[model samples]
Target: MNPRRKKRLLFATVLIGGVAAVASLLLFALNSNLDLFYTPTEVVQGRNDGGAKPDVGQRIRVGGMVVEGSVERDPTSLKIAFQVADTGPAITVLYDGMLPDLFREGQGIVAQGTLVEPGVLEASEVLAKHDENYMPPEVAEAMGKEHKKMEYSEGQSGY
Candidate 1:
């Protein structure tokens, strides 16, 4: 009611508003840049993150085992396509770059890119497991294992 009290209240309100605005901007920036990880089943069945599926044009990361015998490559170009599978189902990933040396059928890998379809991903980067004893934690978890090392015999397919 008093002038001095009124001025103090106004200053407090302004300061709180500025802080809230800055916080909102920071959250938006982080959310926009976030690339959520998903599995083949999650992609097809719809992810349950906050009860919303990933947008068709949203960028994401898919981690799983490279489906055995699912790799197809163009002879004249760097384009390649492969199926990645978890315990539930498989999703196709298309990439246009040199693959890592460790990349192969039954190998665990993570592809980062945009989801152009419900079951297809247009990958911009593909990362393979670095060593025989290591697999990505996300991939392992999706496959029902917790930090399990990858080991496959001949004629075995990645799950």
Candidate 2:
């Protein structure tokens, strides 16, 4: 091939290779950082209903109400374990860090971490509702009709 044509071909090859490399890097970053939100009911049912359960150690987010009377603290360490529940089911979460001041039972929360097993989440981050009336949109949506039932029950009990 002529020198000019050879040079042009080399340039095109390098450009294509660079583009592919960048694309691959972007995909990998996205896959690693993408955190999906699931409710406790969905997590439990997904494990038992022949649906694909999240692989252990895969990053994810779980959203629900903190189950009343489920909070346990080590007192010595920062480790805390609590159960989060949607209207249907509950999942236990273990976290070893400072919890938000607003974190409390019966309040809405989102825990982000990995699924350590079928019923437990090893949370790295915990987010609580900022206000009494505030609930994460994703949590509300995932709760589905169960939210209405909870509201009805709470109203009846005068909570």
* Total backbone collisions for each predicted model: 0, 0
Runs off by more than 4 Å, candidate 1:
47-52, 145-159
User: Which candidate has the highest TM-score of all?
Assistant: 2
Expressed as tens digits, the lDDT of each residue in 50-150 for candidate 2 is 66767777788999999999999998999999999987779999999999999989989999999989879999999999997889999998876768643
Expressed as tens digits, the lDDT of each residue in 133-153 for candidate 1 is 788988777667543556898
Query: What CA RMSD would you report for each candidate?
Result: 4.5, 3.0
Error of 1 at 40 (Å): 0.5
Deviation from native of the Cα of residue 1 in model 2, angstroms: 4.2
Lowest lDDT 10-residue stretch of candidate 1:
141-150
Q: Tell me the RMSD of model 2 versus the true structure.
A: 3.0
**Candidate 2, which ten residues in sequence have the lowest lDDT sum?**
149-158
Candidate 1: residue 113 lDDT (0-100): 99
- Which regions of candidate 2 are displaced past 4 Å? 47-51, 149-159
